[model samples]
Target: MTQGLAAAGCEVTLLLKAPVKTDRLVAPLTGVPGVTLRRPYEEELLPDLGPRGLTPDQAVGLITRLDTENRFDLVVVRGRRAAIAAAQAEALAGRLWTYLTDVPQNVAELTSAAVSELTDIAVASRFLLCQTEELRDFLESSVPAACGKSVLFPPVVVVPEGVAGSGTPHTPLKLVYTGKFAPRWNTLEMTELPAALAAQGVPAELHMIGDKIHRDSPDWAKRMAKALEDTPDLVWHGGQSRAEALRLSAQCDIGLSWRAPEMDASLELSTKVLELGALGLPVVLNRTPMHEELLGADYPLYAGEDIDSVADVLALAADPDVYRRAAERCAAASAKFTLDRAAERLRGYLDLAFPAAPAGTSPDRPLRVVVAGHDLKFFTRLADHLMSLPGLEVRLDEWEALRTHDQYRSKELAAWADVVICEWCGPNALFYAQHKRPGQRLLVRLHRFELYAEWPRKLDIDKVDAVICVSPYYADLTRERVGWPADKIVVLPNWVDDEQLDRPKLAGAEYTLGMIGIAPSRKRIDRGLDVLAALRRRDPRYTLVVKTKQPWDYWWIWNRPEEREYYERTYRRIQRSDLLADGVVFDPFGPDVATWLRRIGFVISTSDDESFHLAPAEGAASGGVPAVLAWPGADTIYSRRWVHEDTDAMADAIHRIVSEGRFDAARAAARAEITEHYALRRVCQLWTDLVVDGTAPERIQLDRFAAVGLG
Candidate 1:
């Protein structure tokens, strides 16, 4: 939850009771990039804090001492005792934000006492809104205090971008469960699932990926160990970090998230469900209205009490097709709850409770803006627009010199600019983020590769005001991977120049298809070949035109043994399929991209994964109908009608555009989309509104792609 707030561009201070190391896995938040951990907070009250807790006077005195040394704009605390303590600290009235997860006993008293001090109350699940409505209404009617509220689930569980394990489930099925082994959680029944499945002639394995051995649970720990020993084929992986556990869960057949309703009657959320879904793994959880809200009412994999029930439901997963469908549903469900989206939603709630302090420079000076980055190609036109704007002085700084004799002069630049927009998540962003002066707003623009790289992990997200993503897909993944505030991350498409992209289409160009950036397997040129081969079988005039620096041109990309093997295999497939005969054409890298694109009437993006593919947009801008393969979030970036699922679909789209006398109209529609949605001036204006006018980034809308009289 703190990660969500930090990522939402909040200056977060994690007030730790004491710095104590234990058996638990290392927390990512222990020394997080943009958060401070304050300790030595009057620990004389620590032992009493557990059961007895502080009296109202003691609570007031304890907190007042802490505040006298370090003041706070807002204080957010959870739990019954903590909420009471914060409410009693009258010096900090009207800034205490209490986050409620479960409807505990005496919760009404807690809410009533905190009403005068609290800015708002928040719940972990939407179910709590209905459950706590009575308390909220009482506070409103009695105290006349505005009891604002919101729902925020745990931060989106990020699945590591590793090679996903693949193994078909056979006679012996594998299941995994993550979470504490509390008595009320029915851990004994969960661990007994495998033995029950085996008794039914279905050999099974239970991989428990959390600690059963805890200092707090000596008796339950011993019982859990004995249960594991008695139960056959059980692997107890003491404890693991969330990332390691999710990665391990990827290989399992089914996820176990069945929790006994010890609290809230299972109406609240189970993060284990989100973890499994993030890994694209199916889960067997107890059926509830909240589960239906998350995974839909018709979701097939439902379970009930006891071990046999869950085992029988997972037995259906023996069928490959059923397992595939279940996994698809899990992935689809998880996509809706990314950390970025959650953080963005949380920021809206926070705004109502505590409005953001205005961010600007003094009125005497012009709006000093500095645009610095490693890759400035995409920003060429946008930079021109920034310079043209009155009352703004924009300076461009290229960081290609960081690797060479040219040293980056970030200190001087940092001192001069009121707002700095770094073009890529490179050295420039890191430097400005670390050394940015007071009152200077910093924005770092990131594309696809940065999310996969280590730069995001090292970035000081607190210093950066915002990180602009080229597309929402990139923004979502980046928030999860980088742990940056989602509110601070804005989506702005790259400016497409009308002078460069809009051009005349050559005759016979309607049959030619163009694709760029082939090196690296992610480009999926092999998929492009599949589409090319399918199209050529229908008409030989269809040819694939690839413009790239040959596979071996960049040694850094092709020198890797795996990369070389993939490149050679792709060539082997091309030769075997006759794509090289008359079906495919390779053009060496050149400067005249618009001319090359104009020679082809259709374009294709066949990447397996992408943040944003410029080739399709450029091709569309150059008067070609872009048929993009559904990669990651391609459907969201490109119009759904232009995105294709596989080779057959892409080939069919190509054949339809050419054979139905729709080439002229389709080409015009594609160019019109680029002109309205991504044209240099329109995109530049959107940037200005976000940076200069203080408009919420989400409020700026782009034009839609629409074809006239096509129906």
Candidate 2:
């Protein structure tokens, strides 16, 4: 919604509920014009209510203060309290347009009563609009008719937030469903839709968003787990803000409009459908009279009564032209129901509700905002970059330094920061829980190390506003093992500053193979040794140069006696032999690895599992042939099919590198490709967009963050 309004030339100020340190909401929205964010001081106005629960009085106070300070043109309510608050603010301001993203049924009766006071009630779908109708009718019949004067606009569609006019339609039949996975609305039913499609040989996937509903219902959660187990095509995720949800939905070829068979549901249309259509995604909606009536004959596929019909629709949607025409029709229909159009229609109603302000008003300067987080080095760099922009002040809170200065722990440091970025391996959730402030955006970067450790189990993902992963692979692993919403996860691959590592690629170094980093178990030093052995066995001219930090026991092992011995006997030998040999060399000093990688001809990784093998990525970036073992976790976590395994295949790859003499061209091409995807500029841009704008692109949401919660 922010992006859509920003694209339409509206300056945006996002009032987050909590601190945003990670790129969950901002990275995807960066580079977009006309949007600015403000990190307001968040205060917990209602202590009795938890994060999801807010009372009418508390809601009114928050909205009134925010509106008084900024006077927004349109106020969008996401959760229940937010809706009520927006409505109250609209009533007070007497001219603010209001839109609700969630189903009205989810809100408390009292909160709903407050929202009914708004000038206009906007829903995402015809189904929801009807649901609003039922609630209105009930309220009117129960109360006085004079109390119900709100207008209902069913199914207002907006372009998927952060997606620009790409000119080409989305391909590959990708379908995404963004919502909570509660039983009342049959959320889990869609979880099985993907596997059902795959079973019938229809290529399709269902990306589930939002937190697991019935979380306390062990039987239901377990059944949901079992149902989605081994469903490779199904990507389950948890709750996310509307901005993050739409950003993710934009990457799909189609948007799913499937809801449970509720009388109220039949009258609603999903926000996903509107977003997908706005982003040029064709849609497959459940057959409902309103959908049929609004969409007319242009409805490409309809799952009338059976879930199996979804597969049939998906199979037909695979054709590019078929999907394109459907998307075009949906887009044409969506423009009629956009927030801009809705706000225009609602202006008169709003004017009637409240008196107008004095004329000749000047807009306030873009909100001066600051975001703070952990890893001072990274966030400092980010802060520096963001500070270069106009009307923005970015700060970095180094908890370690703060402790030195004031003897305060992580909690104290977080309380002083607006946006907190904690290391995935650090005490993120604990600090946030201890010193949480309302309107502070909590962003956490889930690095590769945490994915393999018990940290994920310990972390409270629900408290986190967004998580930035270095790769989609790690994000998927975290989602599968940890159960985080894909929308809340953003994949911002590691950034290497090309200018800093601009040393020329080494010439005539074809025989030198390099392996960087010091990890043994996961890095699989044994595989690199085996590759070296194979190369030497083939020709004595072949040699290996490994740069791993020493002492091997200190650096690689976890202080276990047996583990230390294993490292000393196996990995240390490779390191020691290479160091002692005249031709083979090993440098365990803390020198720059990128410069060394340029001097080597190839890089190898024999890992059991990797979120993303950074060594190989760096090696490839430095103009080396990358030979990586097809790791295990990718298949279960991300449905990966790009690994090359057999020992012979490894040897064959090595032989091709040596015999073909195509190393230079291959190296250049590999460098170009990896740099384009993982360069520091590109990666930082992703972070900036996600952190600054609070939008997570669909591809990053799906491929990186698999699902929310510990599934």
lDDT of 2 by residue, 532-610 (tens): 7777777777767878764444643756666566566765566567432444567754434544555677777677777
Off by over 4 Å in 2: 1-390, 401-418, 451-462, 552-558, 571-583, 633-643, 698-711
Number of the predicted model whose TM-score against the real structure is largest = 1
Question: Which lDDT tens digits does candidate 1 get at residues 1-711?
Answer: 567778887877766544345423336677656776544334454444533334544554655676787786566665545665655556766566555543333435446445443322322111112212223333333332232232234436656677243545645787888887876667777887877787777788888877645446787778787886676788877678777777777777788877665432443466677778777678877776566766777777887666677778777776778777777787788776677876786676565444322245333566888888877877775775666555677887777653221344667788898889888787777888887899889888887766777777888888888788888777788878777777888888776655445656666899998988798877889888888888888888888899988779888987789888999998877777764566777887754565566588888999988777878888888788888888888866777668887889888878987889998888787777667677765676678776675454462233244223233
Model 1 local distance difference test score: 0.69
C-alpha displacement of 3 in model 1, angstroms?
63
Candidate 1: segments with Cα more than 4 A from true spot: 1-365, 400-408, 699-711
**TM-score of every candidate relative to the true structure:** 0.47, 0.43
Q: What's the residue-level lDDT of 116 in candidate 2?
A: 53
- TM-score of model 1 vs. true structure: 0.47
Model 2 weakest lDDT span, ten residues long? 122-131
lDDT of each: 0.69, 0.57
Clashing pairs in 1: 7-484, 7-485, 8-485
